[model samples]
Target chain A: MTTSPQNSADSRLPLVIEKNLDRILDTWISELQVDGGRLLNLIRESELREQASRFLDLLRKAIKVAGVNPEKTAAYDELRDLLDELSRSRSEQGFTPTETATFVFSLKRPLFRELKEAHGDNDTTALLDDIWQATMLLDRLGLNTTEVFINTREAIIQRQQQDLLELSTPVVSLWNGILALPVIGTLDSERTQTVMESLLQKIVATGSDIAIIDITGVPAVDTLVAQHLLKTVTAARLMGAECIISGIRPQIAQTIVHLGVELGNVTTKGTLADAFALALKKKRQKVQDI
Target chain B: MYRIPILRVEEFLLVSIQTDLDDALAVKLQDDLTTAIATHHARGVIIDISGLEIVDSFIGRMLADISTMARIQDCHAIVVGMQPAVAITLVELGLSLSGVQTALHIDQGMRFLRRFLAGRDEEASDERE
Candidate 1:
């Protein structure tokens, strides 16, 4: 049987979706935050820049096949241009500015392994020094351990800052095209977006009826995190996923309770374990009812 | 990083932490100090904070917790290296740490611990008689 040209193109549609996922991630990092290097710097090394471009090409193709975006393809392109322009003048030194751009982009594989296995003194002082110094430099904060903690909160905030270009979500997973996300750390407007896209994609792909998120890792429940989390659950529901929340830390739980914001018919649990358990139970109940 | 203003010489353990005590690191400090103090029966603990610009509630609470925990184990905790702003912020956070000693410099905290240890040794000697 001969396959029509259109049918062949349609077969490659998954490939296109995979390419779009990379585009989405790139745009999200470039536009979502303002502080630190998130693809906002250039590798002054000509060879490395060439390498980055090839990497980008590979990523775009893979993302497109994943059915990566909803309405973000054009925006992703625009953000890439903006980031490319920003990095065009930067030197390739300073821990590979391109690799440090975002956790996903710069440290996806072998390079990350290189960082992990780099040798140091076989002592606690050396190991702690390495981790603390690296963390501080990456977050652009002061180095003080075992005493002053002024920089930790600042560093966390810097990591969580939101720009319009990136999603508000930090963690996204797709199982059989159903997206489930759990966002830890502080949520800014930008991360909230990444979360939404992940959830929506899962809804579309898996026809998912449930998404459970555990917020126990969040340091504090600021208005932005609360609002963003609320928005994501609502959006998921619209796409036909029942979003469940688990792992609300005591401090954050107090803050949310104090804020007196009604959670608008969303489910809550003590932890991600509980949330998933609830999801399984609900799914089972549905089967029984049927 | 705050410049080390106080260096303490102690008979058993030297406790000097030269960083701002934020919640995340404070947790680390709390763990480290508890171990160091126990292992050494550290008569002196010096915390330097001159490098800090701000101190939030979490860190403050952790400091208080560390101080109490150390004292319970018969180890004294001393706080040093506080910047002006950091000191002020902790005060405003409604956190008042009792029994946790603070000095303007690490040297002073050391001297206090040294003196306290000396006094304790003297009492032990007399009690042996």
Candidate 2:
């Protein structure tokens, strides 16, 4: 190991990448294929190679412009964008965070091999210094890739959750003048708004005289949920459609009573059928059970 | 000056709000509706707001005021055809329009008024007996 100027290793890092760009890319792709796992099947071979090539080119350019460390600077903005797109696609394509991070970390081996082969006999100390800088840079980039991957996954989950919330709260017309809204799942403020909007819309469209809100599918009844229900009932009343809350399970009944919640003139029923029957009765319509 | 036209349908007064309501227009609507109720001898009033996409607090308050004024004149005020978005906005704005009675559409509103008036007629006959 021979001592040399510190800046020589940092400066030569980008030069080594620039000189052996094609070879580094080729080696990087092969290395990625070996440990790339299920991500290989998700993305096509040509697309993968193109992505790897672009990343290397961007990496080389960013290093030239931003020096050895390229984190958090305008010089690496394009590189960060590329990584963001790559991680987003990976997330959509079902790649795990570890797998996404591995895509970046896998390039380190080929880069280190190229650096060693290029300057192996020149000076061991400078060669190791170059490898060290490469390791730090790749580690930081790899960590960021994982973060972006996780963020994409979380965003996908949140959107799916919203869709599910919408799907579960549907208002259906049970009769000519009556609407039935069966609420399934926990009642959050956002979901309550959806319920109110849909129920009120159906009432207006159908000119429904009575609305039955069935809470059988709801998991739990808390103060917030009760408040949301009250708000819905009140809104429907204001619209001139009498709202009857039904599907109160034994547990929910106990919960409501235990909480000392005052429903104040709002009618409650033990089952949706009971509420529907009441609605029919209010309309002066009756069904004879055979 | 814009005035929301109030039309008379038989014994009921019909006002279809097809445009947005400003403070002046809404105030005019309140006065015009009550005057029309007396002019037309309308026993029922149906205000159709299906065309309105937004209902701020002021509009909601105007609706409540109309219901109150109609009630004082011995007329049933049935606010009908309120858009779902409007209802949500009204509730979110903490304005329940408690004095106003709502129906899904004109047909329901008419039927509601018919039932109410019929019930009133029965009570009046019973009082005379």
Candidate 3:
């Protein structure tokens, strides 16, 4: 059974990795520690070694089954999964993209050394061929690690935005029948929808008839923000609750007027105190001085 | 023909919609409610719709029409117990029901109608003076 030079070179790389797994992992980890010193501090030494060995084992198996194109084969799925987990954990631990990817690319030097040792001095062409193949596979895996890291970071940002949206809109019951929703941030359409739904839900739960939307924490009131405020008010009114927008800074009021935004019949107050007082008045309750 | 029941409570006629209303049933409800208000000489009408989970644009229009019809007959209409989701949908559909009054529940609706009517009576007396 005679194998072509290409087949022999492709098949021999995996054999070299399997034979020198320990030596490769030792060199890879040391290379990573030198380039990714900050990343190493974030994770334990033993855990790092285990991850490196597992990755090398999977890579060898993948190469044996799928040759050079491990990415297009089911044999590489376990390798990809391991990379995904490593990238996610490293990203969460504050590893930079370069640092995360170095975990895979750093394996190149150790692997090329082992491939050279296996090929010896007489087969320089086979040695170069093996080195090129190893380079291509490692580069693909390195890029995949960076991509996973970026995606994980983006997912975290999206979840934080959702949490911030929920946190900013809080509907508190001020009196027996008055609810106060202090609008602290900029009101975009999505935030306004959350605000509207939450305020209306609180109205039903508390049976509050009046809601004061205090925008004192809002930095600026643009036309779009005013429109969002109106939508929220309209939604609240539809649910049988009146909205009193308060905390309107003088500048915001000026901006609203200059923008020709029609707040029209939705009540506005200069301060949260004034709005709360008005809400109490509408409910026919007076706060008397002792 | 199915009819949405209208209950008369003192000076107000209470219409609690417990089922999803189609076009014909909605129109029949409008007709029945207007007739009920005139015959009972009710001062206000309270429409409770908490049981309704979905409302299309047609039903929104019908609600506005019902309030307008009640107003023509010298009666005030307060829509009560609207679900939060329905209210959001209505506003999103650009049907804020501005002409129609709304309350969180039936009891609040009754209180609003009483206060509203009392205010109107005082204004009428003031005008007479």
Candidate 4:
């Protein structure tokens, strides 16, 4: 490997890439160290440097989308020099071409993003050697983590417009247009909006006098959850229906108070049975008033 | 900080708002909720703000639209869980609900809705006959 290192480096085409790789590694270390890692210490500890490299690559690449200005080039250059020095150390930490290639491959995404933002489609061809390897590895790894990230971001926006879409619950109208909607699962901003809208719409469509929301399936409740619940109850009332909140879990109950969120005088029941009783109590009181 | 909806009820959609309800997400919420309610005929919609640190103008506008739309569908809108900061911001910002009714808690709002439901029932029976 040592005998062919010079030839290998020379033959890799596009002299600038070797320089860039040299720059990226050398700069990343000294500048992006965590817990006060020194350049020399990082070089000595192969595992530590490897870990450091991974973290920096992940964050830098993602953040590169924000735009990598030339002003920060100094930091990258400094770190790359440190790594370059380590690569040439007397202890023989010389990276084979494949290893160097792997390091470059890991950086493919951030590079692509940065290049795209800077020069449009032009950057794609410049890093073909590196990008192709990364792409193949990415395909093989098939990480679905990005999907979750996408869904999460999308869900946030979806909450504002529709509180609810009525995708799961079945709304049935009774003799006096009573509607019972049982909600299960988690609620977020997007889902909260969906619930609010769905409830309001169902109230009008079914003309239901009462809507019971059974929360037996709710896993947890925080400030966001509490807010969504409050919105839902409020919306139900606007539609002219009595809203019943059932199933307050022990942990959730603790969290609500810990967070100091007022349920807005909303009736809370321990179980669905209790919720029905409360709804019935309202009916009885109405009869008495009449 | 993305908040996803797990359950939706009539006029009472349950969603946990999280992360920052940034410009892009706020727009999505407004449009999607508008579509869902328009199709479902939801009268009242509750917006839970437990997971959010703040509510921007975009969120405020979407709420207003949702309330107005609910009215067209014969449903009233009630904004719930307006954090004290949020309330102050909305008031200081000179933003008020024109077509929406708001309550501090869900229970108070529910009582008001019960009456609407009762009144509508009598009217609905009359219409059916």
Candidate 5:
């Protein structure tokens, strides 16, 4: 199978890829196993072999149909789809972006070796041209894998954040006519809305006259946090529930004064215990000293 | 055509809004409540809105207006049993109903009225003395 450069110049590339397809796949798998990264543990050996074989076959077909520039052609659509699915699943399976990207990058060595073996040493110019084209195609595909992987990871992170927002703002009834809302984590506008909604709902459900908003779990208090707290307090008051803001740490007190954010007529206490005591007082219920 | 029933309980007038009110009914309720406050010589008014789930700006303003009308007639108005969603809507609409006093339930509203009237009675007796 020795043909002149003119006979097999532009079209010989795809044929060469098809001819050494098996050797390239074998070399790629052996290299992945030898590298022995966390990819091996996250994915089973059989599964990895299946994906690797499918990827190589699709890639060879795409190159044959689309010539050296597979990425620009519609023929590579299936190949892109396969890679996108692989990256998304890898993200779901807890594989890092590096590992996902490495799956495509690892194909480079076997392909370069195949191109070298397909051409003789005298045809250095042809060998270089083939190597450059292969490099460009693989780089594009590798980048695509990374882009999809990052998107999947971002979606996962967003979902978890929403769940965390719901979980952190829970309102519990402390007594017959009193409710307590313990807020943890930073208070953003979105989270403040959740806090207000849950707190107000509990107040109405329990018919609680007094609400103690405990923020001991909140790490810091800025002007924005102060504003959020005030908004929640005002909403509760409008529902006929007097709001008592508790968990005012010493630092928070200083911060409040420094920010010049007035809490107005809303009552504030140093601790939840003190706030509960005040709520009872306002309810005209006396706690007999034991 | 639906008239919100205003029940007189001792020194306090009790009004429970159980259904969605149209513009005409809401205005009628205000007139009826104010008339009841005067006719019954009530010292306090308690409006139970627990059944009222949606309080648009129109309804919120009506509530505030009722409270103010009752107050001008020498009666303290307490809006009780306001749902969480209603309160949020009121606040978002920028109608705080600042003139109206609030309580969590009818019983609490009664207690608040009793305390308030008792304080007023003491002041009256002192003035008489």
Candidate 6:
């Protein structure tokens, strides 16, 4: 393990890459194919070759300007950008982090072969130093791809959470002056805020006098959930719309009693049908057999 | 001293707050509304806050006070047309205004007041019989 001076290793590294660009790419592609798992069938050979060649071209340019550690310098911005794009696209195509990183790491083997071929038996220390620098550079780039891949997955999760928040709290109009909000999940403070806001907004938009908050889809009844339900009911009532909490399954009713949640004044019923019947009666309308 | 207008519609005194009510204006409206309730022999008072974009705790307290005072004078106070945002703010501020009767619009407010007054009138007649 000879520690060659930084300047000599940095200067010689880019020359080795530039001299054997095509040979390095050919070997890198074959290396990727050998190790490729499900990802081999997912992406085509031509597109993969184009991406690998572009990455190598930018890498050589970045290394020439910013040495082996091109991460901090602006010269490697294009190289980093290409890696970011590759990571994001691969993530969207359902590629695992290991598969995405293999693309960058596979280049190391090909470059090592070319480096060995370029520096024959003479100058063995310089050859080892070059290999070390190339190893460091490829490792950094592979780690960068993994970082971007993980980030892309996190962003997708965050966006789906926002989408779920909007999709879940839908306030439907059941009658002329009635609205029904069917809650379907756990009532956290944030989700409760969303549920309350949407229900209140719909009440104002529809001028609904009576709102039935059917908790049939709600899996459990906790004190916090009860508080959120009460808050939604109170806000609706303050806006001049009375709320009736229906769909109290027997188990939920027992849970409510055990939790000692006071659903005070806000009417509750066994089923949506009974609540709808009461709402109709309040509106002076009746549903009978035709 | 800017005074909020109080329009008398039939047996109900209608107060539509069209502007943001500062402390003094809100107090003045509360004072004038109680006086108008007495002068017009109003059976009910409907305070419409649909035009109000913002309401602080002071204004919320004044609304509750007016409702309680109207009830004392045998006049029902129904706050009508409260904006959803204002209602949420009031609820968040821990002011439910539980004593004040509420309706979605002026029309609903009138209907509610009529039913309430009619029910009271029947009870009074029943007491006499």
Computed on C-alphas against the true complex, the DockQ of each candidate is: 0.01, 0.56, 0.84, 0.04, 0.60, 0.73
- Please tell me which predicted candidate would have the highest TM-score against the true structure: 3
Ranking by lDDT: 6, 3, 2, 5, 4, 1
Give per-residue CA lDDT, model 4, range B34-94, as digits (tens): 6666677665566655355576677777767767766776666566545544543453355
Interface RMSD of 4: 10.2
The per-residue C-alpha lDDT of model 4 at residue B81 equals 47
The reply for model 6, stretches above 4 Å from the true place, is: A1-10, A116-129, A163-167, B1-11, B18-43, B51-56, B118-129
Q: Would you list the rank order by TM-score, best first?
A: 3, 6, 2, 5, 4, 1
Instruction: State candidate 3's DockQ.
Output: 0.84
Residue B83 C-alpha lDDT in model 3: 93
**In model 4, what is the error at residue A150, expressed in angstroms?**
15
| lDDT comparison, 1 vs 6, better candidate | 6
What is candidate 2's lDDT per residue for B1-129, written digit by digit as tens?
A: 778888889988899999988888998888888888888888999999988877778888888888998999999999887776777778778987776788777887898899889999999999999
DockQ of 4: 0.04
Candidate 5 clashing pairs, residues 3+ apart or interchain: none
On residues A73-150, what C-alpha lDDT tens digit does candidate 6 reach at each position? 898899999999999999999999999999998888889888888888887887888888888888988999999999
TM-score of chain B of 2: 0.96
Best by DockQ: 3
Q: Which residue pairs clash within candidate 3?
A: none
Stretches of candidate 2 off by over 4 Å are A1-15, A25-54, A57-82, A92-95, A116-140, A288-290
How good is the docking of model 6, as DockQ? 0.73
Model 5, A206-230: lDDT tens digits are 7787889999999999988887787
- Using all chains and alpha carbons, the TM-scores for the candidates as numbered come to 0.31, 0.82, 0.89, 0.32, 0.72, 0.86
Q: Tell me the tens digit of each residue's lDDT in model 1 across A1-290.
A: 33332232323333432445445344434332333343334333344444345544543453344322312455234434434433333322233343334432332332222223443334334334334333433232111110123233344456555442244353455333223466656767666566666555545445455677867656787776777777666444322346788888787778888988667667889977677667777665422443
Candidate 4 stretches greater than 4 Å from native: A1-169, A172-176, A284-290, B1-129
